[model samples]
Target chain A: MAHRALRIIAAALVGGVLSACTTEPATTGTTGKGSSDGKLVLGFAQVGAESGWRTANTKSVREAAEKAGITLKFSDAQQKQENQIKAIRTFIQQKVDVIAFSPVVESGWDTVLKEAKNAGIPVILTDRAVDSQDTSLYRTFLGSDFVKEGQEAGKWLVKEYEGTSEPVNVVELQGTTGSAPANDRKAGFADVIKGDPKFKVVASQTGDFTRAKGKEVMQAFLKSHEDIDVLYAHNDDMALGAIQAIEEAGKKPGVDIKVISVDGIKDAFVAMQEKKINVVVECNPLLGGQLMELAKKVVAGESVPRRVEVKEGVFTQDEAAAALPGRQY
Target chain B: MTPPDDTGVGGRPARAPGARQLTEHRLFWPAAVLAALLLGNVALTHDFLAVRVQNGHLYGSLIDILQFGAPLILVSLGMTLVIATRGIDLSVGSTVAIAGALACEHIATAKDPGSLPTVMSAIALAVGVAAAIGLLNGFLVARLGVQPIVATLVLMVAGRGVAQLITDGQIISVSSSAYKMIGGGYWLTLPFAVLLAAALVAVTSLVTRRTALGMLIESVGGNPVASRLVGIRAAGLLVMVYVVSAVCAAVAGLMISSNVSSADGNNAGLWIELDAILAVVIGGTALTGGRFSLGGTVLGALIIQTLSTTIYTLGVPPETTLVFKALVVIVVCLVQSPAFRARLSRRRRATAPDRAPAAGDVGARQQEVHP
Candidate 1:
């Protein structure tokens, strides 16, 4: 009886492996654009639906691809580097016209990019860049300048409170520790605000770029510090959380604390409209149309700039009211 | 085993009956340690213990600790029972995500998101789904005889994916006042979350102590084969504990999402299971399973929350905050260990022989054999 059971298990395993192998080639065959239609096939590997910004970015990319009449093979990496690398390899095996991806992290893309390069396929980065040390690995990088976004936030704060001698106690709700956005945003904000003695950061802590943690950390901050003038959050989610915390503490958010944050998600706009948040520095996630254009140009052997910067706008309460109607996320 | 009556061991006298009793009380060290930490916070931060009434609600560091610690207390309470059954549910964190996601998604998509009925239905949906996930874990561990860690791990990894699917990878924000009250609002000048946690704790205690359920669970965990031979129905009890744990996690999820008025699938309850496990361990519940303490777990959760708040109050650098937390946790765990305490006392006795023999001296010498 045991021998028969073992035999059955072995047979089932073999059958499953065979079926998996058979299904793969079928998908590649149908999706492959190596036909007389003369349409450009693009393989886009997305870093999974991690946040509202990412979801908007993915939607934009998908819609733009459809509008541009480009055959897009989309793969969701589920926020794993290995999954992203595997998706890229699958794209290479399928021999798409062009490859593009928003890398999950800054490192570990040298080998895969080299593979795509050797295959004579141009690669474009959207939203996030990689640190491969070899510029030839990809055609160009396209994303908002996170540091510049931070500087703009600082500049806005400076302009708002210009000539005020009273010290402005700023408490920062940073993003996930060690992330590129968190590091660059902190550096940029500090760089712009360092010379001004009136602007002092009383407390800074990582909220891990989440609403719950942001609320919890802000609660702690409120309990610890008696006077907090400004709340500088790395992202809108954290700012929203801090708004809740401030409300729970029985204080006005925008009027009392003058909250400032990054990322232009729709919720941030709603908060700004309600006067709960003071300002939002936009880190635009709608790179799909731009990416589509760049991919087409790269696939056609046209030389593009090494780095492409997407234009973004900072929103005050007034701007938020005007933009809330058209907000996508 | 009766060596204490016959002679003293390791140049120490036999423990006094009162001293032995005190030392054997499992909660003694945990309570003392928690008290010490709270006192330390009071000394370090001015107005740390001050409570003020604001908008007919209590606002202070002490109140904040209980309010914020409510989720950890709930999670750890469930963890204590699971640990008592010789099982670990690493998926509580994921269950938290799924529960919050389901509730927030329901409320966000509802026709009248602010309605009490909508909020009630959303909570029910979240709890029901979480219970089903717990049933799966129990089925895998008890029925299929899978390793507890491995079985729960399946959900630990996949549950976040399920949550993301429910929320469609967006942070669903809702404006339901009833739901918000569950997490962020107050009642009678106290946080609703704390009240809910206290009520749950009381119910859990009454059910476990007033019935044979606790004993049966302990029997099963102590020896599964023996429990089966005695017809203790270990499988059913295991399923019940897991379901209870899932429900607890769901309630915690509700509180968390409600506090922020948003449900983030990716970061709602990240690493909360680890914190719950630490709370369980700090509460004097052995991983090997058998005896447990609900009161100790409450104190453990409070200690952790207080430590976090103290980190900010002390102005620790953001980079070294985690390191500082680790150092304090290590110190607390070391101080709680009977063996470690015994060693310290022994070294002190060796250095100064003139010191009077205290209650711990006899207890410390006896602990050498166990160590």
Candidate 2:
């Protein structure tokens, strides 16, 4: 009895070990809102509530739809591409005015976008872009420029140590290893800092964009290299975690080790206000207003840009303190 | 005193027919593998095994292994019992996420997040809710006669959503020093998490061994029908194990979220169930059920914890990290496995049967004693 159970458990463990069993952000259109006469009906598909950024993004979309007086047919694709595809099909069947979705991945959207295109329902991509050669499938893509955000962090680092000529040892707490943000941020940071001989990325490792891993890897980094001058995390949570690690190591975070992170989550602002995080590069999640505007434009048969980038900026301790009073996420 | 295993002397009496004594030395293989892995790390970092004190707290790779491995040790400790009952609770990871989420959300919304009372209530809420989940899982598996895996799988999938609901789909960050003490803060210059895990292990060992409960659980797992016929309440035992597993996972959840001072519903305790199961297996606990070892699970968890630290200390390239980790785990599994040991010894015995005559004699005596 035990052997069989062990085998099953072992098999289950092996087969599903790597899979985080993500809750695919798949939502079927319920059309819960009152579909008022003459109000533009917009179909929006969201990625799952995987993080604070995603939740804030979802809120921005929902709230913007309400404020814009547009009827939103919202569906959540819990991180599953197939769910997003299914949600898109439902939007097409419902014949909504405009269909908008954040592509869960970079591929497998050509067919669905084509379907929406054939139905004469204009599709707008938000937050994520699909790798479709046929650009006509979607009207516009609205998202943050991750590479630019990484460069902003690097630019801040260069300016912070502008007078210093000594070689600076830096460490990185990267997001998920193969994630778009992790790759782009690392590349952009490296691209900017590469020109300066004094700036050096001493060690870099993936923190999986999680707080626990962020702290764990930071601990390991501190033990391995005691002379780390700066920590460039791909996201705020990791930076916050590294701050705790730095404090535990008996060093002031902003003083001993300058911490730079991406994602302007509220927690990052709090950390900055506390003088833990040195700088935070904002990856704005409030794209709902722009998305609503683009949806209205596409529906009215007006020309829109092929790609739209959300405006974001770098924040330091002073800005973080000023912004913490009313920051949303 | 009643022994933990039902078998008087050896744990593998009926399971294996030959060389049972050598294979049943449960702690030897895992401990040896752990030592080897540490030594391998030493080749890279000279202070791999050195212990130092900084800020009145012990700072070393070994301490890191124990401190960081505390959660896994707790989860695997509970899993050891669950696996001992011929049942598995796959919902542990979800339970962990839910626990952290609930605690963090509570503290984040509390009137005073940093207050001791607030932290205590947050912990109570998480644990209380976990106990209820365990009751549900236990009810489904024991009372309703559902397969343990299937019973727990329902929650394993839905629990994340529940956690997200609690945190309103956000990573609830709290600044509670009292709460952080459970996971990140030290007590008496040692990680409180390590001390908590050690205390739990000691209590569990005393309760399960000093009494006949351990034998009862073994008997129930060994043969459910036979144990039931002997008037043992197998259903109750099943419920107890699942509850224990859930509670242990809840504590692990607290430690994790406290360590980071935040609870990320989607990522907290993600993929931990597999790690706990792997720890239980590596500790020489059979997933099939019966005799178990808590000490082995602790060593196994530490081994896993050390394996990850080893990867970073070696400065393994990011691209090859997963493959490198997999390779080391496979090596550990191979070394711990008795079949692999027997195969190696078989080749050795065949090559020099006459030269090492005493080895053959010992093997014969072992087989004679068992058979």
Candidate 3:
């Protein structure tokens, strides 16, 4: 039994080494062939198609890469940090001109970023930022300010109920617990809403950023608190869910209980057009055209800003109607 | 069966023998525990048991518990049968995602998504495909001799990918009112999902108890080698149980998707298999397999749903919600354990010297019989 175990271990070791050898040359060969054609080769690792927003982001990146004539080698991480790291390593092995990715989470990218830096490849962060203290690891970061998004949502609600003496009891449907967007959005909204004594958040719970859970939690919220006047959902999906619950409860969503959500997805626009959702602060996923521009500048050895903030807009019912014609997500 | 033991201690009035026998029933403790939890909620939350007719339909916490618990009851019912055959279906959650995705995808791409024919075809495709996946799992475990855990684990991982591929990794939204009624509509002043679950439970009970199927499953679970020797067709029974479990999960998936009018492949029915397993265990269906109770499982599912509703009603902090749920579950499981109750009763009798020896003798006989 001991001898058999040893033999199995030996076979596994040999197989691992053989697989490594085969993968190494394949990446290098692609790099050599691409570079000989004198085209800017870029490696973009996406956070997978977990949501409609992510699918739109991936589509934008692919389309922009084609339009800009950049040889973009794309990898979908499928929402796993380890998968993102593996894709980054593959990018480094291929000696891509530049690397860009929207991270799944905020931390644990120090080692992989360092590896890319050592390979003399410039890294650009897109759509989401990392929490690494060493800013020198990446060339620049570009994404929506989630905190600002939440503050905008709060600002809209405050304006809508500006002179109301009746206290506006707001119930917040938070995103996934402890997620960066969830925490920042909650903080920013609370900070802005604290200025008004008439505005008070009655109940808050994490809906885990899914429509089903959002609906279920909203139903419970409706049962527990009968005085809720406003619903501040961290995302449009949750707002949509809350709309269903409100309708089922025989109350008008946008009129009886106003909804303000973030993420300017197409469904959110449609919901606003239907007057179910009151307001939506855009967390734009169309960063592909801008990301390609940055990649080209970096490859050409040109200096760029360390932070590029994407311009976002808030859409009310009227704005939603106008933008519904051209909404991409 | 003894006369003296039937007498109530501590100067309490002696209870009737029939009442004592009812309390000693296997399902009595679990049912009592569920009732106690509901009573606690009533004491805390005003209107906990209030039922009002809204738009000609029932609306209340009790109704919500039954409506929400319907899917779980279905999943655990299937799980009870599978566990009775000494197997588990860990892939039920994945099957749920796949079924929802298939149904939603079919409806979304259909020429007329709202038509009855379209909805019927969508349901058929989803349930049929889910059953095929279950058959694959059964083949791996029963025919190829794979461990049950490993066999189901294959689909548990791969089935999600298949679902994602089918939906193209997007939440497929549909607007089929006919399909929506299955989950979110009201029929005869009750939620349709609740009525569907009740009908399925009744059919399952009749089929299992009225025939020899339930006994054969128990025999196979008790001793597979002996069952096979006795011509029980254990492999076929195992396959049938798995297929049934998958079909139940499919129905649950349809309900979930219909409720939201969208199919989120990644999040729909996520981690539901674990909840179903917990329900089965809480219902006094041993994980080791043998005797099972469908009624007890239904009560177990309701208990879980009520606990969830209670958490939100009580306003427990979101961060500690899971911990609070685990604490309650631990207490319920401990209270349901016969061995634990027996030990506690023995210790109490030891404190009373007059009844110590007599109770000790009964305890010894119980241990002998159980062992």
Candidate 4:
């Protein structure tokens, strides 16, 4: 057993050394040409598929990579910090030209990103940003303005419910606890909602951005509050879950309990069509095409914005009903 | 003389052929809890018994409960095996995401979904990938000597990242009719997911009971050094348990993606591991391991699903449901504790004979002998 253990250790050391020696060619001042042009090997470590928006975003990135003629080496961290670290190490071992990652959480990524930086493989933040104070760890961040998205939802809710009779006993369903989206959205919403004394957020809880959890939380909310007028869900799935809970309670959704949610997913539009949801703030997950383009530009030594914000907007029930057929989660 | 009360012997009789004894040995807790919940639901709701057929399938809130319980059941079955070895797999949720992505990505990437062979190959490949991840988890735990929880933790975090990498952080909407049927289609009068879980339970029971592998696992879990000394290849068994656990998670991922007709790796199996763990724990599997109860796990899964559904049906506030679920978990755990069991037994003796509390708690004597 001692001999076997020693052998395993030896093999791991050799493999590690070999990997360290043969790093993917560094992305110099120029991007690679075509597949025949020695395709730029790009390593992308993604956050797990957590929602409809995420799934679409991943597809977009893969398709964009194919279109751009980049060899995409992908890893799914299944929403864990450690899995992502292992993947990044493996990517460094494979020596990919460039690396990109949508961090699972906001923290615990500084060490890995610094390692990639040290290896001369430029890293880009996709969809989500890291929490490091060091800006030089990564090349640039390309994603939606999550805080702004929350602000938009809050702004719309303020205007929509301006002249209501009963104070809007708004219950906020937060995203995954400790996630960037959850924290940012909470900050943005509270920023606006705090100004209005009448607009009281009676309850707030993490639905973890899941339909089941959203439904569970909503059920509890209905039991506690008799006169909840509005539900500000962090995402659409949570809204959908809340809708189910409302229906089960024999209360008409849009009529009795108004819902304002982000993530203009197809299902949310369908809910809008059924008058279950009142409004949806759009977060364009089609950043993959833009991300791929930016990746190429970054590789080409072309100057890019430090933070590229994707063009997205808020949609009311009327807008949602109009775009129900075209809306993509 | 009288077989030395071999039931109390170490290492589960060390190769005994008493499958019936395993099943009949424990009772009450799970069954009684389930029975109590069912009676409460029936008595509380006006139309709890009402069932209807919609689109040629059963339609009711109860159906929803069963439907939601399906994935939990599948994951818990795998968990049962791992927990039986005094090990835990925290990565099943992530494995589900990876598997779901692989399944949907395969169908979406195909130029023609009509190619049955290609689809089959993709499915096979995805299952293979899931198995490989499982193998890695097993290797870490069994060979590298990492704690099972910590070994699987890496996958739990990185597995979803891998899935997202596959789908490129997108929701891969699959239009394949075959894929959709796995989650959306009905089997007989029940959801296909429920049917799949039921089939898995039966097959798992047969495999564990019929083969020496099952007994070997129990013995190893019960006493690792003794089993190793007896030439049971304990490391190999540990590895197998994790691998099987991952495969089960993959199956669940397929069902989920099909039901939604899309694979969103980020959202595919989020927090599902929590549900699976709860199910395994409630099903009467000790958190510290040794004995596994597939039947109990199923009942536990059903109870959890029903509790969630009931909260919705009964008009509980959405935000409080998490607290409620946490509370239910706490209550169940407390009830299972030895101290609670002893207290209840003492209280029972003071009450009337007919009204004595049901034997829902395992005796302290049994735990001491086993531990």
Candidate 5:
């Protein structure tokens, strides 16, 4: 009994990361066993079901994989880096033909990527990327361009004010402080808006990317600055919150404030259709179909671009009615 | 000068003051800090304290503070009692999320979401689920002998997941005028949320103070073994407190979700538990348990609310807002602390004897020499 316990402890220590599946890829498609079935097996680790967009993205990936007749091994990391790392190591042990994941954060993946590289499993990044200096660790990073989304919002705002040379006093409702999306969106919007001398952001504050804080902060902005002509929110949730505050303050949101927001959620389209929100820039969450295509190409040893930006669009009030019924998120 | 009898765990240790001066009052620091923060806002924006009527309702910065802070006030009110019982309810935030998610999910799925019956049923379902969760928490701590923090932490983490499951991982938006009336409507020129919170706070104060329930709760908190020896049902008291805390959190959740006309399972009531705990601590309630003051907790909640409003009113850049709020909160806490005040008074006595009060502020320090 003592000898058995000792052996088990030794085995646990030896198994540093993954507990390798003993059955070995369900008796087919191990790639090393000469690919008996010729079916490509993909391992995917997701960044938990945190929001509408993330849920949509996960669904897209799952459905696309199913439609493409590929076997998928999916794991949810629950927005933790360690969990993602563990899942990746497990995938490596499982000897998946291709491994893909959305990194919870941008750093601390060098060790795992190196291990995957050693195992010769080509990795693909979906939805988000890692800040590794060694680019060879992953075949491609497929995601939305947040900065471009911000610019789209700003561009719409400029076009709205094109007929008049009147000074535009803008109030910004930012997302959570220090978040990548918040920083990128703010930078992108500022770059576009600064081109016009008549435009100035009069009041700016972090709404922490919630409806409650968005409304509360917007109320203060309306109170402090009575001449606010525009409201640019980093996301749709905040924009919706600010719309309530604007209405409470007896001002029409889309007309009086010319509200422009990012993230084309279903509610945003509803708000746009109701003429409460002027424009919405899409941060596409439907990356599943694209991901499956990329996964197949990488596993087939095709050389893809280092970066692939997801296709998104900018929507106006007129386009809202047509878009709302079919909106996924 | 010396402390009065029964200066329990984490007590002030000094009761020499006869309440002759305004500063001697327990509520003086919080009230003063609230005034100072509002004054700062007023200085920055000339109409910071202004209140006026618009569309047959009171509209102003003051009103907005009460309106926005109503949910926090309700949560903190319940937290005060839980702390009074030598217990903490970290699950209140999760409870908030769950309640909101339940209600929003119900309303969103209903055929006539705008109908009064639909809204009423939605509220009932939400509250019922919250109460059931409270019962579970109470059972865990009272019957199962699990530690309060550990017990509630389970819910705090899993409750959000449960909430996400209820909403199906979506930000469910509902349009119901009847549902909105709970949080967004005006009642007699006041926010319905504020009135509801006020009424609940008042009822809690009366129930705890009017009857012998308050003393029983405090006794159980002060010394559980002694309370048990004295024939007090500590388990019952424990269960009662957790349930009450959860009920308050549920109402707060309703107000928040109703106000926004939507419920976000992931973000609703996120981190509100920390704010509620802070409010209780700032209100001079000791976490080690014993005595509590509902009025003080209300003031603490108001101070926190006012501080946030003042931050926005001042437009103290987006990045520095959190840091600035933290510094102000630290100062408020330092001023409220009796130990800090005693140390400050001792330093002042060493430097300048003429500034000493005849009533003796040094009484708190005198207890330190016995150690």
Candidate 6:
């Protein structure tokens, strides 16, 4: 283990120094001199390849940066906070005009963002946000309203079963434990469900936003709850897992236990079209073009908004089926 | 000045039954874990005893526990063998993703709707992809002598990248009936995936125990120098173990994708290596190498799955479950430690001298120390 850590540290240092020595201005900002010749150097620390949405988001940002003539230095954090911290430090040392990242989780980022800020490198949050109360740490956050998405899912549930007298035994398949999405979605959905005493979350567990884990947790839910009327998954993968469990029990998923989830990935749309899933609240992952545009604006000394909300919406079976062919995220 | 053979038996010979005690020594803690998990679950829920079958499948928390545990068990079995050699494969999770992607690719690209041969070919392609990764891991570790963690980690990062590249960041929905059977099929009211796990366990035990392979592995783990001197072919064994582990992860990936009927490159098998490692550790395999227990690993997987199931069943806050599991694992490790047991017995005798150091006093000492 000691040897392995040394290798990792050595590799990281080499990667850092290599990135630092490249003297040419690889990118240009949108405002000052974003011409092809005058590019603004920007570094992006990604949160590893955690999901399909993440991969798409990373590609979008990279492409957007290229299109905007910004020199983009990319680092894959592999889902570790320490690696991300190191990447940010390297970006700062490189004296890039701008730095941005999709944090793996919400906490443990204040210190690094503060460092970047002190170094005069403005940071932009792409997909996920940090928990710091100081809004001045980063320029702006560009992402979905996760809590609103959850509320939308909840509202849809309330409306769907408004006239029914039967009590709805719902089980929630949450994302990673203590993550922003997990906490926000749980809070948002529970806030709405609190008013209806007839609806109860019979069982809830974290699937960690992975298909295998989601399936495992759903299996556990199937065992404990005999009459789960609805499964509210934090993502479509978990919803898909619950669908398997529902089918394995010789029950129809759409008919026996309704599934409402977030993350309108193409597969989720397909599932919706097939009647395996009932609803999904879309969290647009194609935020790259928007993030790059904002990064350029920040570096150009332009006033960007404190928070730029991505255009996101909810999808029902009908809508999902209709949009399956064109769904990008 | 001469080295005594650790593999030497007590009296008759080095291969005698008494030496079996060496491997058997690690079984107690896993059993205790199983007992604790069962008691905890039964205590938490009144209907834990109820069992039912629905839709030609078993419908109980136990089945749910097993269903969840199957993949963990399969992967941990391989992890146990790998860790038994003082090696870790952080790339197993990504290897799983790659396998799933490969399977998805084969199924998605295949034009045959219901052809059995094409489905078989896809399965072969998936398994072959997993084996190739295993071979690569083996090559890096056994040939290049890179640290198992590092070698696997390179793949861990790059493997998922490759999977994403193959899928083009798309979750390929597999419509093949043959591929679906791997995850969604059943046998005698049990999930076929669960059965597959059992089959792997049975086969692993047979191969490891029925031949000299188990002894060779233990020898390599306990004393690589000595094993090499005795012509044990340590490198070949190391490579073989990692390859086997990779194949197991691939099987898990196949099952996972088949269950969902889609291949997600990003989230196919995320952080599962951690669970597999934890299961191996909880099963009494020393991370430092030279010891392993397959049955104990199976018990460990069950304990983990059951604990998670119990947490959800009892409506415990999801965030606290990890803390609880960490505590339980720590306690189990402490209890299994010989040093802890020695200190405990010494304290027990110091506390009360009259009972000839009660054989069953371990639990009492554990509660006293923890509480």
Cα-based TM-score, every candidate: 0.93, 0.91, 0.91, 0.64, 0.92, 0.81
Per model, how many backbone clashes are there?
1, 11, 1, 56, 0, 6
lDDT: which candidate is best?
Answer: 1
Tens digit of lDDT per residue, candidate 2, span A148-267? 888899999999999889999999988898888999999999989999999988888888998899888888888888699999999988888888888888889998999999998888
Question: Once all C-alphas are superposed, what RMSD does model 1 give against the true structure?
Answer: 4.3
- Residue-by-residue lDDT tens digits, candidate 2, B1-371: 11344233344456444555545567878888888898988888887788788899988778888889999999999889989888898899999999999999999899998998999999999999999999888887787667888878878887987998888888888889999999988888899999999999999988998899988998888778888899999888889888999999999999999998889888888899999999998987778787788888998999899988887777787888989988988988888664566666667888876766765555544433331
* Predicted complexes: DockQ each: 0.47, 0.37, 0.38, 0.12, 0.39, 0.37
For candidate 6, the per-residue lDDT at B348 reads: 69
lDDT of 1 by residue, B75-112 (tens): 99999899889999999999999999999999998999
Write one digit per residue (lDDT tens) for candidate 3, span B1-371: 11122211123333334564566555777798899988998899878888899889998888888887888899899989998888888999999899999999999999999999999999999999989988977876687666677678777876887888898878888899999988888899999999999999999988998899987888887778888898889889889999999999999999988888999989888899999999988887778777777877888888888888888777787888899999999998988776677777777776886874854675545534431
The TM-scores of chain A alone, one per candidate, are 0.91, 0.90, 0.89, 0.82, 0.89, 0.83
Give residue A44's lDDT in candidate 4 (0 to 100).
Answer: 82
The global Cα lDDT (0 to 1) of model 2 is 0.85
In DockQ terms, which candidate is top? Answer: 1
lDDT of 1 at A235: 97
Among all windows of 10 consecutive residues in model 2 chain B, the one with the lowest summed lDDT is B1-10
Q: Chain A TM-score for model 5, please?
A: 0.89
**lDDT score at residue A274, model 1, on the 0-100 scale:** 97
Which residues of candidate 6, in runs, are more than 4 Å off?
A1-33, A36-49, A58-125, A130-140, A163-166, A286-305, B1-28, B147-149, B356-371
Error of 4 at B70 (Å): 1.3
**lDDT tens string, model 5, B248-279?**
99999999999999898999999999999999
Local distance difference test values of all predictions, in order: 0.86, 0.85, 0.84, 0.76, 0.85, 0.79
Over the stretch A84-132, how does candidate 5's per-residue lDDT look in tens digits?
A: 8888888888777888899999999999999999999999998787889
Point out where model 1 deviates above 4 Å.
A1-31, B1-24, B357-361, B369-371
Off by over 4 Å in 2: A1-36, B1-24, B349-354, B360-371
Instruction: Supply candidate 5's per-residue lDDT for A270.
Output: 88
List runs of model 5 lying over 4 Å from the truth.
Answer: A1-36, B1-19, B355-371
